[model samples]
Target: MAQELNQLEDASIVKELQRRLNEKSASLLEMEQMTRRLLSLNEQIRHTETIKSEFISLIKTEFRTPISSLLQESQQLVENIGNTDVVATGSHLHQQLLRIDFHMKNIFAAAELEAGETRNAYVKVRLESLIEDALAILQYVVKQKQLRIESTIDLPEGTLVTDAGKMQLVLMNLLSNACEYSYGGDTIRIRGTVEGDRILVSVEDPGEGIPEEHLEHIFQKFYQYHSGKTRLQKGLGLGLNVARGLVDLLGGSVHCTSAPGGKSTVFTVSLPLKDDREVKDTSDGGNDFMFEAF
Candidate 1:
């Protein structure tokens, strides 16, 4: 009996040792997984830092030319005061100033949005005038690309009232992107119409349409198509992201539709004019502004 008891004690000790060894192996596996996760997070941080640096460099490059032009143009106006056509030179100066103003406003707006300092200033503004002004602001860009702006705002005067500044920014970004993505001499269509209590504005561009896989990701902050479109266009990739954020804040939604090849890309923004409840649809198909690939 004493021999049997001694054997049982030995068995218990071996079982205990096995349990501890198993626990140690599991702990080592967990540690290895944790280390891998940590390495992945570090790599992401490095990538974010690199993108930010690129954005900063792009901003500097964008500002330098216009600022330099403003200086030179003003100096020329002062020196050759009588020789220069006062009206034409003044118009040139105004355009240059507008370009600077546009950049400053967009950059500041983006910064403010990043800092969560967004606040709406609601005031009465005409929809037609607002759109025309956005187009006017982007005139230089359009002219550079040789793109045509075929705008039609059908909403009646004083019918649409919202945060004009934010709306203008939304329009500006959309228009800018339209011009950027379109080929030279392509026509950009901007249409605004009232469907019940909702204002639907769509901007269409006839450039190389966004890929089917990339449509879902275009609005992600600083997201650019690195493969097919990186060489075709250059941007900070903040425009669409900012546009969508502002739309959401303003109780509106933005949608995009594009074909596969070099067909066309379209973005539709639906803003609530008054009612926040369900948009009353009269048609059998439902929503008037369904995203249709052109």
Candidate 2:
């Protein structure tokens, strides 16, 4: 009787161990399936982003030809015409064509920055002058919106080591965003200062501020905000993301602040300051994008 009881007890122990092992095996299998699904989703997202980048590139390349032709024709008409009326009409058309061209280029640049395809050709650049140039680019938008542009630069006038073109691109996008979100007759204040070894620049616009929840994701690519009230602006939502990406590439960081009324947004970018001896001046005398003749 004792021998029979020992055999039964051993069998029960083995059964319990087998059951635990089966449970663990099932759990591991489920976890593996979930990991596989997540990877598949990630691959799909990457594929979609690639498709978007390619599509935007194609549009930019194709659109430039017609836009350039239109601009040239308008320019010729303005110069060749003797009538004031005809010249004025030609000028209007020219400005519209230019705006369209610039916006398209912005779209292309935004996509390139996001895709990590933007080529950086860093050279000696005048940091102060670059800020001025960027302000000039958005001068037209500011005038159109009747917003005041107040700027202060504390950087020394010399050769600054950085990517001139890329810096200009970042400035253009930030200024463009400021203008877009700002109300007409609002004031856009831009301030630049040196904090230790970093160049801190901030653009403040008292327009419609971003909501607290949306502020965290504002830098994400293609993030559209809709409150079921009305469409705020027409955009591919690539501007801020592109700006952040370029800033990051330039060894910088960006942050934002939105008010409770959701009517003001302030963006700040901090970049590592290069030695003043390496800075070079690239100013075009005056704001290039501002049209004083008009």
Candidate 3:
């Protein structure tokens, strides 16, 4: 009986030992999972910090300079009332305000897109006229940089039907970027052509070429290869991202490719000839698309 009881006590101890070991294993796995989660959260925090810094720098240069110029330009016109041409000053003022307006529009558009509040309006749009209007918005920037424009538009007016406002914004973003990136004294090409019921528009700039790695990430919001106040390029970093979103919403796609010999970058937008889907109410109370004089 004593031997039997001793064997039973040893068996109980072994079973208890097995239970404790299993509990320890589960605890270890949970700890490992927690550690991985912590690591992931840390990486996210770091990325957000970098983006915040870039946004601050972008606002300082992109907005502050133009607004300060508006004030200075007005003061100069006032100080030399007869010396400065009234029409020229007014035009300058108009361009600066246009810059601000475009910038604000992109920001709000991006937000609406993120929140999915954008209303899509389907209409017959003039492809040729849209290109012309994009050029007008950036006329001052092009002249300031002494950049030459070589454009070829084979598209007839009202050839394509899609979201007119989104289309204009995409063109404006692409043209503005070309103006910003092109080397002074170099010519930028804007071309539109049709192939098999699809429309293709390309904007090529003779700027320092984008690296292969940077090309992939260029369309990411708040992403810049070089950031901070000293970076050569200044933007909200939303231009390409917003363009891609609007293009996708319009049932089109946009991509960037390096020009032959690699000293230039070309951004090409591809779209179908028509989207026959029923139109819905506008989400943001946005203005109707209108052509701007170049």
Candidate 4:
């Protein structure tokens, strides 16, 4: 009877040891899963932080130009309030304000695009008028650079059924890029024509053309070609990307070609011709009259 009881106690001890071993194994497995989850969360946090940093840098650089222009013009207007040329000063201030407005719109549009909102409100607009309006807004930059603009328009019926605001943005970016890169005495050519069911607009500049390798990537967001330690131009590298995005939303295509030795570059945007019968009013009814400065 004593031997049998001793054997039963030994069996109980072995069972308890097995139970404790199983519990330890489960705990280790749980810990491993938790560690993996923590690692994944850390990686996600790092990615979010990186994107936030980049966005802040982009806004700072893009806003600098317009804000500086506004401050300078405002100060000038205040100083010349009592002068006979106050009218001219006010005009300059108005232009600067327009510049600020343009940049603000770009920032909002970019954010929308990033959020997968590419739909635009279409309207019947004249391509010539849009081009002229863009040129007028860029007149200060043209005068500052002493650059001459030569424009030729040959559209079918001189009308386009599209988003006038988006088209203006596209034209502004292309023209601004041309003006910024070209020499003081250089000539920038803008030509628009209609062929079949498509309209083609080209902006050409005799500036330091893009390298062959960089041409294809120029439309990428935040992509800027670095030729040396110092950049050949100053920009937030968002213009081309925004232009491409707007053009794509309009069911259009944009292409770039450069001369050998980076001597000249031309950007062309092709859009579908608007059919009057299929046109519908898509204006937001907001007074964008400020954009029609011309």
Candidate 5:
């Protein structure tokens, strides 16, 4: 009887040891999982910080040009108050204001997109009007560069149901990029067409085209292609990304193709034809005034 009891006690001790070992194994697994998660979070935080730094640098670079121009123009106007050609100085100031507004809008839109707060308000809008508005806004830039814009609108004057505001932003970015990269006297061609159930718009420039490898990553946020010791152009590198995002929100696709030897490039946007039945009512007045031409 004594031996049996002793054997039972030994068995109890072994079971308790097994239980403790199982608990320890589970605890170790949980700890490993927690550690992996923490590492992943840390990596994400680092990436976010890197992106924030790059974006801030780009913003400063982009703002410098326009702000300097504004300051110089203002000083000239003040110095020559009566002697300066009022019309010319006023026009210059107007252009500078437009440039500042354009950049500010893009920056705001990019922030909204990053925060995932941007929403599309679809309305029946003429594509031509949007294109014209964008061109008008960038007219000063084009004149400054001695660039010519050749536009061919193949679609009928029929209004398309879409987010006119966002679409305007998209077209502006494309046209702005074209003008920014093209050399003096270069012609930037814009063409719009209706293909099947989609509206296709293309902005082509005879500038230094993007490289094959860089083309794929051009639409990524904060992505800029560095060429040798300098960058291909001066920008916040948010235009294409914001444009792509707006296009996607409108249920469209954007793509690019470049000619060999970086001689030319084309950015195309394809958007679905609006179905009237699916249109949403956004009648409540909002910030449409912000996008209006000054």
Candidate 6:
């Protein structure tokens, strides 16, 4: 009787062990299948990302050259329209073309900057002349907006080695911001000076001051400070970000200041000057032009 009971106990133990082993094996198989599925999904995601990147590159290569050509043609059209006798409609068409060309160039520049292809080639430029040129470009736009844009520049007429075109764009971006944020009959002031080895330019607008919370992120890409949906304040929110990037490319720094109830905001840029010889450009072998009368 004792031997039979011991045999029964051994059999039951063996059955229990086999049952636990079977359960563990099934769990291991399920876990393996899940891991394999996860890895396959990860590979698919990587493949999709690769395809998107290639598509963007292809689009850029196919579109960049034609866009450049269109911009050039539009510029020529503007010049021709100015010189030739044209009706009001022709003049309006020319202006519209110029506006489209400007937007296209901005898009191109932004793409170049994003692709890490922005080149900084500096040359000796008359600082005052550059400012005057930028101001002239904005004069018509400001007038259309019915905004008063004024500049107070108190700097020695001097030359600086910088990317003149980029500088002009920087000024235009800031001026555009001022105009875009201001109401009709609003006052916008642009002021600058040569302080030490740097030239500082500032644009102040008395429209709506940026809130404190937004100030920290104002330079971020695609950031708009206002919540009101008004025509006066609309953009891709790219101007300031691109301006900051361009300024940094030129070895300069841009900053902003704002206060609550101040009802105005200021953007300031400080750029270093190059050497003195480049400042005083001698056109011929004759005497060097005075450096203080740029």
Number of the predicted model whose lDDT against the real structure is largest: 5
What TM-score would every model get versus the actual structure? 0.84, 0.68, 0.82, 0.73, 0.77, 0.62
List model 4 lDDT by residue over 1-294, tens digit each: 999999999999999999999999999999999999999999999977876687678677666766787787778778877888878767776776766666666666677678776555666778888888888877767877788999988775636777777889899989988887777778999999878888899999987788788888999876766454223235666788988988997899999999745478899999998766645454555323223323
- TM-score ranking of the models: 1, 3, 5, 4, 2, 6
Compared with the true structure, model 2 gives a TM-score of 0.68
For candidate 2, the 10 contiguous residues with the lowest summed lDDT are 285-294
Candidate 5 lDDT tens digits, 1-294 = 999999999999999999999999999999999999999999999999998998888778777877898888888888887774867987888877887788888888887777787666677777778888898888787887888888898877554777878889999999988888777788999998889999999999998778888988999987876553212346777789999988988899999999745478899999998777756675575324235322
Candidate 6: tens digits of C-alpha lDDT, residues 51-122? 666545644643564456556656666767765543543544444444444444455566667877765545
As a whole number from 0 to 100, the lDDT of residue 176 in candidate 6 is 74
Lowest-sum lDDT 10-residue window in model 4: 285-294
Which is superior by lDDT, 2 or 3? 3
For residue 68, what is the lDDT in candidate 3?
A: 93
In model 1, which regions exceed 4 Å deviation?
Answer: 84-90, 226-233, 275-294
Best by TM-score: 1
Model 3, residue 135: C-alpha shift (Å) = 1.5
Provide C-alpha RMSD values for all models, in order: 7.9, 6.6, 4.0, 6.7, 4.7, 9.2
lDDT (Cα, 0-100) at 263 in candidate 1: 88
lDDT of 3 by residue, 12-105 (tens): 9999999999999999999999999999999999989988887878878888988998998888787777774766987898898888888887
lDDT of 6 at 292: 17
Using TM-score as the yardstick, the better of models 2 and 4 is 4
Better of 2 and 6 by lDDT: 2
Which of 5 and 6 is ahead in TM-score? 5
